[model samples]
Target: MLVERLERFFQRREEARRRDYFYVTEVAKCPRQIFYAVKGFPRPPLDGQTARRMALGDDVHRRIVNALYSLGLAVAAEVPIPENGLFHGRADAIISLGGENFVVEIKSVHPYQFDQAVAGPRRDHYLQLQLYLHYFDLQRGILLMENKANQELKEFLVERDEKVIQETLDRFRNLHRLIFGEGRLPPIPDKSDWEYDQCRYCPFREFCLRDATEPPQDTLEERDTVPSEGAPEETPPEKEGSGKERPAPRDPPPEDGGMEEILLFDL
Candidate 1:
């Protein structure tokens, strides 16, 4: 009964539809998928497990923010970056530490990902934080990850890099022109993009693949696209009669179970 009630409650979620500005986290994902979001394309509704996990993360995120606020560490909580006509997002907090203020973004992660993050912040998380720092004009940012299973914490420090920020901004700005300004979409998934990994979970898989049937007219060179490296590879079929076939894309995240990290950043 509780499961049914919870499912019904979350089913009413209507916010996932579409928007103009890119969420900070979405910028770090497959550009094609992000395009789908901004264009207001149809996608499968969030599954029950995924919805439940988000609810769990919300509870944990709120409680943690309150605790951090009380500790004198947080100068501000749930701070939204002023959408300077490009990107939109909320930092978990602006935290004071060692005489400096850092834009802080927190996450609820599975143990598997938490272990991977011990080396550094997860790729998508850092990308989001990097934007937070650049747009906020802050000197540094913090990525605080909590393991949902056990409440263990992993923290990463990120310093602002103008080079990275500029590259990212240029990329988003171009997409904004095409998506918003020109009413065009980003290019089809490049072979290196590991679109294979992303297609399964993508809301616009059929839409993308169908459009991809035409001759490739990629606006950005394949080399210009950043390679994401996290998903497991499955060798795809060779393209008909074309010597050039796409390699399995390396960077879109498919959850180990159903805990897609990207969903937390979804609207």
Candidate 2:
């Protein structure tokens, strides 16, 4: 079983490499995270919990597609978008409804998330569907979300927003300029607190934080000044006034087990 799991994992990774472009879902995430990804920075290995959640989400998607087919609806599964060097994605299914075709994007979320989404589409989820709508030239699409815990279903009808789509495309282009053109990393969207809950779960946390701590190396003089290992440490001169002791460093708090599952279509 372990061998089979490893094989499947590598197969997915290989398939991901073959498509060397960003997904709409990824571009919806923090640009700094995307920059690290595009630069080929190493990320932590996928945990089993995350893997299981992703598998479950895939199963839910398949089941939804099959159910649509059973109802005698025309369903196109895994519809690929036009290949753009900067972005690409596949709609889960396109179903013909009421004599009109509509894109279908499925998401499996926790009960609380489902409740929130029922009120309105989440930012990332809404952006992903809009990209699909723009790419397929469709005006309307459906967002189907299932509550993972209770298997409850909720659907929302989303119309294409040309302005939003254009904004998203512009953002992606700007991000490309920062990362690929200038060879500079984007600042973290939220950095006021290092112990921010989301930062703990971010895949690029180590790389992002490490870069934040180090000074930029824009010149040879600055680069050479960085001490090599075993070099004598320089001590600051003692002050002539009263001295104050520095506080000892404290360890970070334990992270919560909140893993963000990499969805199937994004993968």
Candidate 3:
């Protein structure tokens, strides 16, 4: 029983590690190619003030949704697309009026996200909104930004660009491949242009970026040694174990070895 538990524990650990690696790789690769890739960026744990603000914004958005519904539009708030691998993205406000549907992405940007959108551009937001648009089969969407100054809401209507949509989809698929192909993370780019002010907030920012300086390594060495997708297993045999009848494999496990049990010390 003890041995079985220990084996299961190790297996779980292996699976978790693989998942973590895949996540990092996908996060690193997706953004440049897919405009909406930014939505996939791992969020930092919010502080008390930020958390409260986010909650309030959510409430405000919900209220705005209610207003939309009252205006006699066939509205759906926080509607989800289940067919897309449980993509938990919620459209802040969805309106189907005059036989046309519109996906509304509401943002409570206090000039930071707003400024970034104005200057650097919010590719992630565009990509995510586009994805939502695609799922709903809608060619039009809106980016609603809340203004604290006027206590009024401003809306930006975005028409679906087939080129942008198709390109973003392609990038997403490639990112999916980079993640699940070998269950490993991609290395950070050296010349990672710190164009986004939000880069300072990224956890991997330390490794991928510096104080307005390019990383020492311009490009990561492509390690051919690393396993590729659908590649044949090249795992080596145990150091001292021999032959076809070699005992199950070892205790505590070797670094490169897999889940196959090898009982080192006989009971």
For candidate 2, the per-residue lDDT at 173 reads 84
Worst 10 residues of 1 by lDDT: 229-238
- TM-score against truth, every candidate: 0.76, 0.70, 0.56
- lDDT (Cα) of model 2: 0.60
lDDT of each: 0.63, 0.60, 0.44
Candidate that scores best on TM-score: 1
- How well is each residue in 57-160 modelled by candidate 2, as lDDT tens digits? 78998998998788766368888888776776789899887677888888887675676553566666788899999999998888878888898877777888
Error of 2 at 260 (Å): 27
Per-residue C-alpha lDDT of model 1 across residues 1-267, encoded as one tens digit per residue: 698887776763222234567777675566766665555454455656666676787898799889887876879887888857887677889877777788878888777777776457766677788899987889877777888779987676777878888988998898888877886767754645332355445555655665442212332233233323111111112233333335545543334211123221111
Greater-TM-score candidate between 1 and 3: 1
Q: Between which residue pairs do clashes occur in model 3?
A: 25-186, 35-123, 36-127, 248-262, 249-262, 250-262
Residues 38-145 of candidate 3 have per-residue lDDT tens digits of 212222233444344546666767777787777766378877654553233456767775677788776665544454344322454556677777777888777666
- As for TM-score, the candidate ahead, 2 or 3, is 2
- Give candidate 2 regions above 4 Å deviation: 1-20, 190-197, 212-267
TM-score of candidate 2 versus the correct structure, residues matched by position = 0.70
